[model samples]
Target chain A: MTTPPTTVPSTDIEVRGLTKSFGGFLAVDDLSFRVEPGRITGFLGPNGSGKTTTLRMLLGLIRPTAGQGLIGGRRYAELPAPLTTVGAALEATNFHPGRSGRDHLRVLAGTHGIPDSRVDAMLELVGIPAAARKRAGGYSMGMRQRLGLAAALLGDPRVLILDEPSNGLDPEGIRWLRGLLRHLAGEGRTILVSSHLLGEVEQTVDDVVIIANGHLVRQGTIEQLHGDPATLVRAADPAHLAEALHGQGITAEPATEHGPGALRALTGDMVRIGDVALVAGVAVHELRPLRTDLERLFLELTEAPAHRNRNLTGDATPSTSTEEQA
Target chain B: MTALIRTELRKYATTRLAWGMALAMFLLGAIFSGGFGALYVYGSLTPDGTPVSEVVPPLVLARLVYTAGIQVAYLLALIIGVLSIGQEFRHKTISGTFLATPRRGRVVAAKVVALVVVGALNGVVHLLGCLLGGGVLLALSDLPVFPEPAELGRTLLLVLLVLALWALIGFGVGVLIPNQVAALSIAVAAAWIVEPLLGFGLTFLDGAEWLAKYFPSQATTATLDLFTGVDPEFARTLGGAEDPLAWWTAALVLLGYAAVMTVVGWLLTRSRDIA
Candidate 1:
């Protein structure tokens, strides 16, 4: 839970009218957002919401059909040494089968005139020194991901873009990745990491940009997005609890019935539970507040009926809505 | 450009496939040359008369250079060419490669240069193996232990040209296919199977005689005339009855294939998205 240092650039990445089409279907369309530096921006979306495509376009792997994405006021292809400018791990397993993990990094390091020592240093940094000599084909998915990260860090880049870097990582590996990213950001590098696993990116990201059906649904600080105080409360005496809550002008709905008189209520405040118990003159043994996790927020943001219908009909065209609210 | 070339060389040097192909080419050449030398030594003796020249340079060198230098070098070139570009896409390593450089054109150019250098190296190795095996055969036989400078030079030059062409052709195929398995299969089939079959079939076709000269295998066979000394009658027979092109013309045609394929591959590589 190390906070990113203040030296990290607060510069923002801006995308406008970015559109990409594979034949008749648009993979990314009119999508625009800003990823502020000095903060871990969580790029979250469903499987095909253009997260990977957008990242590719941003990295200049594919040309945008009608728009532009900029890093530090220039396109990725325009950068003199992209490795030194923007470190990226778009795919965790992108490696040549015959090359050793150490050689893989060495080749990349050679591209920017970086020393071979950097390869060894990065390998050790990522905790894969033992596996460095083994061919990349033999590496587990987790080891490949680490090797990819080592490559991304070869030039000591200013910006980092990683997509689902924790796919096959163990709990310890995931935590290690989180710490490493935070440390890199602490050194003034702008970081943008994407993951479908909401819980994985929850504690790591400072801000979040959510998309559904190739449309930007929400973009803001985690505090602004999840700071709202809402909790679920359950109590005994189902009928009495509802009636008592209603008389108090507090909204309460039946969540579920467990036993003869035990009941759960979806309410905003847990304090209301104590008041309800005191007013109803009931002895309360089980009262708990349910906190909102990233999983629930993700579902609420992306599970809209409109999104489902668009995805079903194959019309999830990226709408030209490049709105950004810092 | 230097950095790109260095990167390509580094890749080639470290890959296991390149080493395997090189070793295979060396061994295949040695075995073929040794077997041919043994036969010549046993067969070239005078029955009831004195031996004129016990050493048979043509048979020994031809077998060594053609089998190892031409055939094995071609296979090795194809392997290197395909692996150079095809492996990047196959393993999804292109993502990281482009990420570092982002200049697709330069990367491709480097690959072409690397493949050509590798082809040259293959030629050098083939020459060394030929000389070593030929020298040993000459020593064992009761023939004059002397080498014809002109003939040996011509043979070496032809071997070099064939190896270079092999690499160029391989580069074109690898770029067009951009998959190691597919490129290798196409190269192998074109060399070992398709081109020979096409040549055999074309010889019987009404008007395909002249056209057959342009097929890679036929062109290579015609190009081999530089070493064996062009027999005008044989050239005409292979060129066909209608309007057969000259040996040089056939070589140019094969060169044209290499040029066109390389350009197309370069363009595709420059524009294609790397996954």
Candidate 2:
């Protein structure tokens, strides 16, 4: 990984109205998103939110009931050299218990005429060189995760789709993986990493495609999703501030959760709140737009009732439907 | 195709299951061949107070000795085939396998080729055990140990083919039943328990001979029926049909079974979701 990044063909991932239903239950419903090359897009969803199903469909391990899960404008099965184009590590347990870690990679490497040296190199790259000879059955969860990662990277694939890649990683291992993913994505690779936890990938992904109950909740950059126009205004007199904001056609409610004398504007421009405060003679000590908690928003978007959830329209308001459901 | 086959072969080689099964094949081959050979030779010796070679021709006796273990050895081959595909499903590694090679037909073809090679190796090991154990007993019985070299060569070739075909049948069974325990149970029970009883009934029961020869086990016996060369009368007494299938036809029948199993297995595996 330290060597200069090898030039790899840029590939984008596209899911076009993909839908999958098992028996009568829909797992993925008309989900669509684009993951561009050279960026890490977190495929964020809660457990059983169809993230794994979507990824498996993209890799052609599972067939979509309708629409398509494509890589670089083609189905995964149509790729001339699929391993070289898109490498996926679906689960850590997708291994024979008796096979050694190194042998597992060698088995896959042989299919593509990949050299054994590359297998060893991938083991080293994943920081599992010492455990390469050990049977996978005996591997710790972190080691198995590393081995799965090694197998995924063995082909030097341009695109990597990993499902819960950091499920068993420790803090240190997670950090190491973050660095490694950053390095690989830096090489213009299209990396779609699925996770049940958003905080796990919030700092790591450039863009995110969030789904809940087989429906797309949101898809955008972390910055855009974080650009929640709700402003946090702290004044000496919270009642006066609320009144001034109400007169300016912006609803401001006392936000005791943040702090006393702080008013949270439901949705308004920052300049309008400041101007309203200045004109009304309200002592405005602090006025700044609140940086929305993406984690909480992710939980809210995913946990909220699907029918009433207005997340699809990118509404900044934190839906209170989940609180009602709770 | 060659690379896929090579990769499949590597997968079987990496597991301890294959080696353990191979060891079982050799031991079973040796014990059955040597024990049966010694029993026939010594039993005849004790009854007549004379060498058994005078009663049974050396070529027929040698064929009996070499092939005594194969009845049991072929079961191991079938098990090998079953486990080859069964292990993948049981371990849930089939997803990764399909991911690497999306063309399911190619994967099945490679597995068949690899299973054949493994079956051949098991055949060789079983033959080695037969020669080591049966060869010594034949020599000690005051018989020509290498009786009819050309016939012996044909028998060895048939042994490999029979084992390989059995492995294919096992592969088919594995594919038809992805549950390892259930597949192994039904395959072994059918081959070991039920088929043998049906075979016995076919031999002794009235008006049953026509349907008997088509059974996979019966076809296997007919394919390797070398006794007709040295002693046709005695071979018939041992259950040779009044109008038995030609060795090649019997071989074709066994192959037919393998093909049916493989095609069905391939079809189920091709479109079935790996997850």
* TM-score for each of the candidates: 0.83, 0.89
Highest DockQ: give the candidate number: 2
DockQ of each: 0.61, 0.79
lDDT of 1 by residue, B1-275 (tens): 88878888887777787677667666666665555555545544334332212422454334333343355556777666676777887888888888887888888888778777887787777666665665566567644333566655665676667677678778878878976898889889888898768877887998766677677765665555532432345324323223344557766876787778788888888888764
Off by over 4 Å in 1: A1-11, A231-290, A309-326, B36-69, B142-146, B224-252
What is the C-alpha lDDT profile of model 2 across B171-216, one tens digit per residue? 9999999999999999999998998688778867788768877888
Chain B TM-scores across candidates: 0.80, 0.93
- For residue A43, model 1's alpha carbon misses the true position, in angstroms, by 1.1
Query: Residues A1-326, candidate 2, lDDT per residue (tens digit)?
Result: 83576757899999999999999888889999999999999999877888888988888888899999889999999998789898888898988999999999999999999999999889998888988898889999999899999888877889999999998999999999999999889889999999988888998999999998789999999878777467788898889879877887788888777677888897748788878888888888777766666777788888665623332446445564211111
lDDT of 1 by residue, A1-326 (tens): 12224464444677887898888877776888988776788999888888898999999898888899999888998899888778888887688878899888888887788988778888898899999999888999999889988888888777889999999899999999999888777776789999876778999999888887667888898877765444344455667776887788766665443334544455556777788778898666666654555576676677666554254454334422111111
